[model samples]
Each structure stands twice: as C-alpha cells, then as structure tokens.
Target: MVHPNTTPAQLSSILRKCAAASVLGSGKQAHRHALVSGLIPHSTLETDLLLMYARCGRLLIARQVFDRMPHRPLHSWNILLSSYAQSSLFHHSLALLHPLLASGLRPDHFTLPSLLKASAGLDHGRTGAALHALAVEMALNVHLIVSGCIVDMYLKCGWLVDARKMFEEMPEKDGVVWNAMVTGFTKAGLLAEAFNLFQKSQFEAGDADWMALPSVLSACSQSGDLRKGKEVHGRAIRCLVLESDAVLSNSLIDMYSKCGFLDASLHLFSRMRVRNLVTWSILISGYGMHGRGKEALRLYEEMRREGLEPNSVLFTSVLSSCSHSGLIDEGRAAFVSINRVYGLEPSVEHYACMVDLLGRHGRFVEALEFIGRMEMEPAGSIWGALLGACAVHQNVEVGEIAARKLFELEPGNPSNCVALCSIYERAGNWDGVAEMRRKMRDLVAVKTPGCSWIEVNGERLCFYQGDVSSPSSKLMLQALRGLLG
Candidate 1:
C-alpha cells in the first residue's frame, strides 16, 4: 500500500532519524520501504543509507549499500571512508583510498583528514607523507584543515622535523594550529621552542587567548621556569582569561610546586574558588613530592571531609608520601585498606610504592612477599625497587634473584645492569661484577649519560656529560669545587 512516488528527500529524512537515534535496525525497513515504494535511490539517498548503516554498527550492510550505489559521489566516498576509519578498520580505510583516486576523485580537505587520521592511528608516517604529497600536488596543503592534519600526522609519527616544517609552512594559523605546535613541543621536551611559540601567541592572540597557555604552563613546570610561569600567570590574571577554567588554575599550581615553591602552590590551592578533582590531586601530589608526607595526608583527610571521592590517583599520592617519609605503619595500613576504605583497587603504582617503602626500610623479604601476592605480574618498577633495596642492604640472594628478573624484564635498561653490578660489588663478588660489565659491553647497553636543567630569567639551560668545553663551565667547576670544600 506504499506510494509509488517516494522522493529521495523523504527517504533521507527517515534515514537521518534512524542514524541519529542509533536505531539502524529500522534502516532495513526504511530500505525496504524505498524499494517497494518504487523509489530509485539517488546518490544522496544511498549515501544516507550507507551512513545510517555504518552509524548503527551494521558495517556489512553499509558495504552492501555502498557496492549497490550506481553512482558514488565524492562526498559519499568520503563518508564511507570515514565510516571505516571510525570503526578502526584502518587497513580497509587505507585500501579504499587508492580506489578513490582511481575513480578520478580528487581528495578534498575532508578526505585527507580522515585518511591522515587513519595513518596516525596506524603510526605510518610514510603513508602520511605520501598523503601530504598528494595534498601538495592538489595545492590543498595550505588549507588550514589539511595543514593541521599534516602537522598532527607528522607529530604522531614522532617525526618532529617534518612536523615543525609543516607547522612553519602554514600560511594562516589559528588557535588550534598554535596549540598543536606548543603542545607537541612541550611533550617532546623542547621547552625553549614551546616557550617561543607561547610568546608569539601572546603578541598574535594576546593574553586573552588561553588556548596555548596550558601547554606553555606545562612546559614551564617541567622545565622549572617558575619565573616565566609567574609572568604568564600575571598576564592571564590581567586578561581575566577564563578564570573559571579549573585546568589553567591546576596547571598554575603544578608549575609553582615544580619550581620548588610549595608555599606558593599551597596558597594558590587555598585561594581557588572552584576546585575539581585535578586541583586536589595536584595539590596533594605536590606536597607529597616535597617530602611533606604528613601535610599530604592531612590534605587527603581534608579532601575527604569536603565530600570528594578518593580515586586511584589520590591513593597513589598518599602511598608515595608514606614511602618518601618512611611511615611504615601508615603506609602498610593504607596499602591494605585501599580497596576496603576507598572502594578503589590498588594499581601497579600503588604496589610499586609499597615495595619501595618496605625495601627502603630494610624489609626485602616482606617486599618480595608483597610482590608475590599481587594479582597481576609485578612490573619493572616493583623489581627495580626490590633490587635497589638489595643494593642498599647487600642481600646477595634476593639481589641476584631480583637482578635476574630485572634483566629479563628490561633487557635494554643499562641502569638495571649497573644496579646489579653495584649489588655484586657490595657483596665483594668481583667476578660477578666483572661478568656483569662484560655482558653489558656485549649488549652495548651503556649507561645513559647524566644531564641536568636549570632555569634562569625565563630561559631553560641544559648541562650534559662531556659538554663542559664552554668558558662558563670552568667557572661552574670552580664554584662546585668551592662548595665541595
């Protein structure tokens, strides 16, 4: 009894409702209605059908509809490609790209973003480079969306040089583009570059632009540039920049702590009008990091009194405080009572913290027993903590066992080998120490060179091993020797 004059527009409306409601099971009925109503599906209508099926997770039906389409529009092809990408069908997405090219469909911005997303998800920068080349060939590289995708794809593949090249080549930059480069540089530990970009954003977008502030603040925190962080904080306050933004406040608190000014961090935490879980977590972790375990615990009690739930991260902070302060009884109580009291399971980090606490207090046997009782396999940190205790207390039997496990767990970690050597030396086993060095030489796992960072006048400076040929280094050496005397 269906009408014979069903329009594609009518079918599209029905399909939209189905897709939005995630009731694509009814899509089959809609398709049947289109068929029996004598409606000839147009390109737009078929694309709607494909999207409806894909959105409902009925990918097989979607492919069938795609295959049955007599004329696939460019947008329709992009939709199908996105469908596959969204479903994590990465290989299918990559394979489908060639056919899109063969069909004389030049990829637009939409097409490349989806394809580039798939490439990033797969960590295949070569394919991404090829896609970038295709965009350049089409003169679409300068398009903001395409350019952003290329920068993101390169960064995701750990190709910083290429990422920076793409970032610098952008003709017109937006807040998002600036954020990507700043965040990328921060994550890569290129604090100088991140700060420079942050400074540029200040002039270009002004202090009112809070887009890159969080990334710049993070770089400042990690680089220990408290002076620079305070300047940025002053700018944000002057701009009245999103004062309601809790994340920015949290980043400010974190930067203060990382700069060795716990009092300033504490003051900021106390002054915050709106504190989220991150705010509390950062505050407690900050106090704990400064080795003020009692203060961290007091804050934890205060946080709980405020009716905030304690998560696994909060518990980790509490446990780390106990470890650092050698609060055996409190650490033990927290470790055993985590699940019972807080309804939070102790993660690997919690277990590792307990091991560190027990091991540091000359409880190697107890630490190993705890590791044995863990539901999951003990990770490298757990074994490393136990090994460290053995090195300290010279427990040859336990040290050998822990070192052997560490060797298997982290074969490429030179520190593990060095720690094992130290344990053997502590036990006066010269042959064992010699053999350990020989094995390390064979593996070419040389100890990582030591390095340190210092922040001065909002700039970060680095000093590395064998890097003291500069004139300032002689002055630094003299100062160090004076301090030693």
Candidate 2:
C-alpha cells in the first residue's frame, strides 16, 4: 500500500507535525519505519529526527543525529542551540552559534534571543553586548524578540542602568519587558525604582495589582522596609495571589522576618494551608538571623514531625542557629545527621557554622582540628572563626596561624589582615603588628566603609561612615551644645 510518489520531505513534515502535536508515540513509530525503509537518510528527515530526539530529552541521540547530517539548516542549528541553553550548558550553546555562522546561516531575530539568554546565564556581559550590536547591525532592533532578550540579559548581569536605557528606548513595550525591568531593579537592591514601576503599571493610581508586586515585595524584604512590605502584602491579599501559592507565602515569611516582624511571620506560616521545604527553610533562616535559635530548633522538630525532610539549606539554617546559641554538641550531631540520615551533603556554610560554634565555646584546638579534617576544602570563614576564637582566648600563636591561613585563602581581604594586626597589638608584639599593617597596605588595599541607615516615614535614608549631609545635622549639634552649657 506504499505510495511511490511520496517523498522524504513529505514524511519528515508529517513527523514534525506529530512531534509538535505532542503525539510522541506515533512520531517515534514513524521514525522507526522511516529508518527501516532507508528514507531517514534524507537531510530534511535528519533535522526532524534531531528535534524529536531533543524534545524527548535524548540529547546524546540528538547530537548524534545532528553530527551525521550531510547538510544542516538554520532551523536545525537553532533547535540544538536552544536545547543546550535550556539544559544549562551555556558554553556549549554559545559555542554552537559559531558553527552556525560559519555555515552561512545568518542569525535572524529568533536565533539571537536564545544566544543572548545563554550569554546572560553564563554572566558573559561582553558577549551579550556584542550580540546586541549584531542585532542592531542586522536591523533586528524593532523585533520584540531582540528587545526582550536584551532586557533579560542586562537584568541577569545586574546592569540596571543599561536595562533601563534599553527599556526606555523601546518604541513598544510588553508585559515580559516590564517584568524584566522590575525583576532587575529588585535584584539590584533598587527598591524605590521597582516600587515606582509597580505603581505605574497600575495606571498610576497606586493600586499596584500588577505582577511586579511580588518582585517589589522581594526588594522591600532586601531593604527591610516594613511599611512598604505591609503595603505589598495587603495588595497581595486584595489581589488574592498569596493564599494558594507556596513560593509567595515563603517570600512573605522571609520579608516579614527581615523587617523585624517575626510574630507576623509565624502567624502567616502557621496559617499557610500548604507548606514546602522552602517555607520551613525561610522560617528557620529567619529565626537564626534574629538569634532565636531555640525557636528555630523547635520548628525543625515540628518540620520533621510533619513528615517534611530537611535538605542542605535547612540543615545550614539549623547549624547557624546552633552557632548563634553556642550549641556545640547539637551542631555536631546535626552536621553528622545531615549526611548520615538525610543523605544531604554538608556544604561550606555548615562547616563554618560548626567551627564558629566550637570556637565560641573556647574549644579552639578542636575547631582547628575540625577544619583540618573536613572532607571539603576549609574556606576562609572557617579560618576566620578560629582566628576570632584565638582573639577571645588571647592565644597569640594560634591566632597567627589562623590569620595566615585566612590571608592566604583570601589574600585581598583586609579584615583578616587587620584581625591579625589587632592580635599582635594585644600580645605586645609591636614589630609583628607593624609588619601586619604594612602587609595589609601592600597586599590587601581596600577598606570596607562603615554603613548606616535610617527609616523615616516608610522611606529609607542611608549615610556613609563620614557623611554629614542631613538637614538636621547642624540643628542636632547646636542642641547638644546648649545641653552641655
């Protein structure tokens, strides 16, 4: 019943249609028939076969089919590039674009977006800018695809100024474009800008029922702006967006805690109809941050009792709580149980917490040995903990060793060098102290400035270590002088 007139192009079109329709079973069966009938040797059929394989997540088979293709089309190249990008192989994705260009396939608007996205994921901002220039050179600037990709790339790279400029220059805007701008501002700690955009998207009435509210709320959490955070929460409640979604709920919990409203956070957590691991982790991290270690541990027990398993992040939070509370044995037991019981690998944060816990309890030697015995490389934080302990115990020799190790690990960090200098001064070794300071000036040149902030009427005001630009500064000084007289 075979039709002799049917060509390989027709058969490949049918297979691609089936794949697009999500009828994978039938497509696979057709593929087997095509191969057995010697029809799949056609280049057109090979493209369809590679796309089918990639769609099914059989990347190895996809790559094999792609390599065997006698002729490749731009569409086939784009499919493989997107596959690698989506699979988080950014370098592979970017590198594949080269061969596509070499094959005389001029990248259209569709091709550059995925490439720009991959470059962003890889933090290759220079490559991203070069792609933008190419897009302009190719006269693809008006393409929504190119514009949106640039927005996302700039956002991911934390270049908010460039993102805003691109956003402003666009003749037309879309929801995705606005979302990218809001997300970028939020991630870059520009709470005011994110909030303004969120408000503007609501037709300028301050309703802010837009999708950007969640991201703005995240920025408020970062800035610890409680007043603004409450406003966003109220808007979420009115919009009916936070009740059912676990991620939003977890974010709210984190936001409330960061704003110093733990009671509200606990209430919100308890009232959550569904809770995920992130929910428990957020509350635990909140408690740890606020020095409520006992509450955090209690919640950990409750989490386990409720049939939720602890992951590495949860264990790290609990270990941090133990460090804050000087619970050496509890921290040690939890560290061991993370791998032994929960099958979670301990990260560097857990190791640092353990060292801090032991060192805080005056067990300096044990902390040093613990760092030495770690299965992973001991990071600077661990050495810093031991050095701080030596400072507390006035152990000059141990302090010197810990400081040296920390300096080696983080050679450009001035804090470690300064700590060693202080330890020498305490030990009356003026020569050693002078040498440490001189080394700090030479090798670790940067100084971390003091930071201050004030919250006034839901707005934040920041002051640097030596700033005196406040309007009330002169008045405060005069009032203090009058009180002294």
Candidate 3:
C-alpha cells in the first residue's frame, strides 16, 4: 500500500526495482495502491509500469500503458523496444526504432543491443554496421554489451572475419564475449575453429564465469566432436553446471547422437530429472537419425502422454524416420495426428517429408497430386524427392516434370541439375543428358564435392572427393575397402 502523500519519484523507484527482480504480483499490487492513493501520477508512473509488465512477459499490458501515457521518456521507448526483442518479435522491434529516432529520442547503449540482436537474425550486417556507426557517434558503442551485440551480429550474418576482428579489438573480453564467438563459429560450420577456441578458452577463465559451457556444448553438437564434448562435460560436472540441468542434458544427447553413440544419448536422456520439449525432440531426432523409427514413435507417444505436445520439429524427425525406414502407414498416421491431436498446422517441411515418404514408396502420382494440392508453393526438396523416386522407378515422364519443377525452384543449385541429368541418364536420353550438362556449364554451376572425416590415433583425417591427403591415407583406404568387401 502507498502512503497518502507518497511522491511519484518514490513510487517509480519501487516499481523499477520490482521489475528488475521480476516480482510481477508485487509490482501489480503496488501499481493499484499508487493509483488509489494518487501517490504516483499516471504520466510519471507509466514508464516503470510498462517495464514491470514487459519483465513479466506481458507485452500487451505494457503496450496498453505505454500507449496511454501523455509523455514518455526515451528510456520508456527503450524498454518497449527491448520487450519486443526479448520476445523474439525482431521485425516489430526494428520497425519501432526508426519512429522513435525520428521523434527525437537518441538511442543509447541500452537500445543498441536489442537492435543489433534483431539485425543479426535478419542477416542485415550492412545495416547493423551502419547502426554501429551511429552508436559511435553517440559515444555509446564502447560499452561491453553493445560490443558483444556487434560481435554476435557479425557472426550471425556470416561475416566471420569481421566477428574475429571485433573480438580481437575488444579491450577486455568477458565469458559472454568468448561464448558468442564459439557459438557463432559453430553455427557457421567452422568446427575446427570452434574446438581450437574452446581449447584456448581454458586459460582465459574466471572463477565466476559459467556461460561458456553451454556454448562449448553447442559447438560439440554441431561438430560431432565427442572427445571434446566429453572433456567439457567433465568440467561442467566439476562446476556443478549439469547436476540437474535439462538443457545441458539435451545438448549431451545431441552431441552423443551425432557422434554415433546412441547408447550414451539414451543414457543421458534417462538421467535427466526434468525433461522439457527440447529433451524429447532431441531424443526423437537422434532415434530418427539412427533409423530406429519404432523407438522414435514410442517416445513421441510418451511425450504426449506426459502432457507435452509435439512441435513441428518433433514431427519432422518422426516423418524423416518413417520415410527412411519405409514405414509409409506410420508416416501418414503421424502426419494426420500432428493436426488432429497436437493442433500444429503442417508446414512446408512437413509436406516435403510426406512427399518423400509417398514417393519413396512408388506412389508417384499421389506425391505429384499432394504437391499440387499444397496450401503453399512446393519447395525444391519436395520436387527433388519426387524426381529421385522417379529416377529409381525409371519413370521418364514423371521425372521430367519433377526435374522442371526442381530446376525452376533452385536454378543456381548444381545438385538439381545433376538430378535432372541422372534422370535423363536413367531414361537412356543421351542427348537430354548432354543438354543438361551444357545448361550447368552455361550457368557456371559447380557441384560441391562430398567430404567425410574420421579420427585416427587422436588425429583427424579428412577425405574430399576421393582425394588422398592424409599421411595414413593408403592404410585408411585399404581398411575401408576391406570393410566394403
């Protein structure tokens, strides 16, 4: 309750502290008490009230108060911008910044982080750099959070050299800064660099730093580097970071599964005391990747039984498993169940999976009909799947149609051209095959070679398009050929 003569300043302070602590109920009570006692006028109290609502994930309430305010401070606009960014409404957050600036509110360091984060998601590196220049002009760009945001923005936008330069130029690097670099490299598929950085990060640690482990584990998941992942897990255990953390356990499952250790993935999943949706999805995806569709479906049912609805990703994994294992009925049943039971509207990815499943089963006509009936345009993958099935079944006419669709969808991708050529080859159309090759040449499309790697005696050995570059290449090739035989 507010005192009869309480001032607006005192009430604003209380509201701000309540918001920072995320005590929404207390904040709401205080707001009501302030109104009843007229201790805090609506104009002065609106900013803090909006902040409180935003902190509690009530954006609509925050907007209502912000819209009703007679005059709002620049910080109030910052709070609203931050609220949108935090909620992952990035485009909406960016749309508000221009109007706020045009109205004469100079964005400070606090405002730039959210804006940079939104730009990162959109891959707008040039625009982000322009904003960085604005931050410098305001003398607010040197702040740690803003620098971190710039690093993250460059990394997400695939400007790795710029990201590294930003990292190197920083006067002081914190755990958050290092973690962002690791995560950025991992997402860009720079596995060797991520691991090298993880090794270097050990000497750069502090007693209180705990954010880097999750980023390191994320690198492990992407790179399939089991040894490094285990070493990091050991350190996490020592730090008590994974004693009961479901998120870390899910990461462990993903890393282990990628490394082809399904047993270890299952073990980690079993040990998790509190499993969230991601945990279930990781396990489902792991099982699908390993071709254990029955087990994947079993876990899917168990997740629903435990009151967890399968998201689109979970359905993707289940559908992929069914497609790979020739479980056509099971795939169809799961697809139907997605809409009927979980209430998740099927996406283009789900449609692609369905086409793959049907096409692989030699239901070419049905697959074509499904593509035609899609609520949205068919993506390259859907057409490519039908084309591949036609190639396997030696159906020239259907393959030709699918090829035309694939070519139109992904003209720049040489894989589609190769698919069309393969279809021509299967149909004994020598001239058509030559024409497809000529088209590839005219388009300057080069097929990217497939590469694989394996570790031998603690050294990674990589092979590219049958290239022999390793010191032990001959022995490795012999062993592989023996296994093949």
Please name the candidate that would achieve the greatest lDDT relative to the true structure.
1
For residues 283-376, could you state the per-residue lDDT of candidate 3 as single tens digits?
8888877888888889888988898777898889889888877888999999999889778899888998999889888998888888888888
> Relative to the unseen true structure, what is the Cα RMSD of model 3?
4.5
lDDT of each residue in 209-320, candidate 2, tens digit only: 4466668779989877788888878877887878877777787899998888999999999999998888998898899888888888999999999999998888988998
Query: Alpha carbon lDDT of residue 387, candidate 3?
Result: 82
Error (Å) of candidate 3 at residue 367 is 3.1
* 1 or 3, greater by lDDT: 1
CA shift of 74, model 2, Å: 2.9
**Full candidate order by lDDT, most accurate first:** 1, 3, 2
The whole-model lDDT of each prediction reads 0.85, 0.82, 0.83
Of models 1 and 2, which has the larger TM-score? 1
The model with the greatest TM-score is: 1
Give the clash count for each candidate. 0, 0, 0
How well does each candidate superpose onto the true structure, as a TM-score?
Answer: 0.90, 0.88, 0.80
**TM-score sort, best first:** 1, 2, 3
Residue ranges of candidate 1 with Cα displaced over 4 Å: 1-6, 17-29, 38-40, 53-64, 84-89, 206-209, 342-344, 392-394, 456-461, 464-468, 472-474
User: What pairs collide in candidate 2?
Assistant: none
TM-score of 3: 0.80
CA lDDT, candidate 3, residue 428: 85
RMSD of each: 2.9, 3.5, 4.5
- Pairs in steric clash, model 3: none
